[model samples]
Target: NTFFQISDLEKKLEVEKEKTAEVSGDDDQEDKVSMVTLSGQEMSFESRGELEKAIKEMTSVVSKAVAAKEFRKADDTQKDVDALIKLREKLPSVFELEKQLKVMKQDMDKAIKAKKFALAEELHDDVEKLEMRLKTERALQPPPPKDLAGRDTHSVKSVPVVATVASAASVRSAATTPAKQPVLPKQPLEVSGPSSDKTVKHLRPSRPLSATEDESILSITQMLATKRGNAALLVGPTGGLAGILTDTDVTRRVVAKDIDPATTSVNEVMTPNPTCVTMGDSALDALSTMVE
Candidate 1:
């Protein structure tokens, strides 16, 4: 009878041990699940460092997609970026928690040495609470704004612009109407003298300013006056031409409206995505484009 009892007790003890192991495994799995999430799917990371590295890689991918003009892919990847950022925000400061734990341990040791058993015991309990709270505590900071592409505004380069002309209905009708009239001898009409034959390349390049810059409109005006320039090119974050801020734009958009130039940014008054022409194109062609 004693041997049978011992065998049964051993079996029950093994079962209890198995249950405890399963519970520990589940807790570890939960921690992993709470670490990071993307596209409604849970992602497991062993450490915060791994999670940060993933965020950087994914952000770079998104930027590349945007620069490639793959809007759909960029948009999809942006969702994952947002999710990772949110997860990062929820993570506690490991360094801060460890520092606090170290201090508490030292104080507890001092209490013990002084024969203050109650104080030592209280500090010990506080340290355990803090350790357990590490997994649940969150930093809860606001996420930074998303900047997928055009992060470098200083890499400005001039590219040859291709002229894209749109056919107007009025112009088409005028052409058709004049076709029925008797043709006259071609007369050479001079518009702007020798300048008419000159190409856009002969003109001076506009000063470049970043569209995201905090340069005030007044400051931009001062820059234009100092450089003797009529216009400034507003470059986007990607170093591509974004818009143009002309003296006329400031006069009409700012002065005429009684807007405060000192407080307003250049982008606020600048024209966005202005029509462009190639530097090799004739000045007359550029003039026609402006007139149209």
Candidate 2:
């Protein structure tokens, strides 16, 4: 029985070889392929195997590009890799690095033009992004003269004209400005108990949300049900009301999407501070700001 099986395998190999020989030089013949399609509702990739393969391949591509000093290509491949990593809610650290590099480039351009060599030195020193070696090489090479510098032998204005304000407004102008006062009246603004025929307009955008207030979804929902409020006051890292969130925005970002509570980071949802407020505003001033 074993011998018969071996004989059959030999026969199969011979037949396959004959078929390959017969099909030789057939360029028009379509190559065999297997394709798999996926639904967004299902796994983003067709399977875990496919996803892993793609991740490893992208990483290898980027690594090779980096080794070869092809930094621009490496940066691009890094972006594609970062996008894939984000599908798992992982950080896109490389993307941030790319942004920093871009900002440094802009700063370098401005610094060179303005002759702010100190700033350019700072940017170059602080820039710890990929393609650093290549960029460093290019940076060491001096820039060409400006168009005007390269122009006619006889020039009307050989010397450049640059001017700057000697000084800003006087220190007294800032010192004499009055501080912001609180919005609370000498007496509390009265509201009818329980039953109200009319609603108070709370349109001022400066309302300070309390620090003691909970940051739960229940807290937010309850506020929306009772108040004609458009936004929630987000507390800052310093443990004070930081910024605000709005209902229309809530309807768009969270409530409508039903995003996973565990996976979704609210920091992205929360507003950042130094939020468009009048500087030196007091708590009462901030509240009165809302009432006004």
Q: What are the C-alpha RMSDs, in order, of all predicted structures?
A: 18.2, 23.2
Cand. 2 Cα-lDDT: 0.46
- Model 2 RMSD, rounded to 1 decimal: 23.2
Residue-level lDDT tens digits of model 1 in 38-101: 4566676544445555665775677679778898888878677655645543443344466688
Best by TM-score: 1
Model 1: lDDT to the true structure: 0.60
Instruction: Quote each prediction's TM-score.
Output: 0.32, 0.25
Cα deviation in Å at residue 233, candidate 1?
Answer: 0.6
Local lDDT at 278 for model 1: 58
The reply for model 2, stretches above 4 Å from the true place, is 1-207, 211-214, 260-265, 279-292
Output the TM-score of candidate 2: 0.25
C-alpha positional error of residue 215 in candidate 2 after TM-score superposition, expressed in Å: 2.4
The collision pairs in model 1 are 150-237, 150-238
Query: What tens digits encode model 2's per-residue C-alpha lDDT throughout 1-292?
Result: 9999999999999999988877773522322222222212222442222443455576677667977899988887766654553443322122233555788788888998999999888877766533453343333322222332333222322212111111122233345642522322311232123222221223334444442222554466456556655566655333444335656435644675665534454333333232232322234545543432
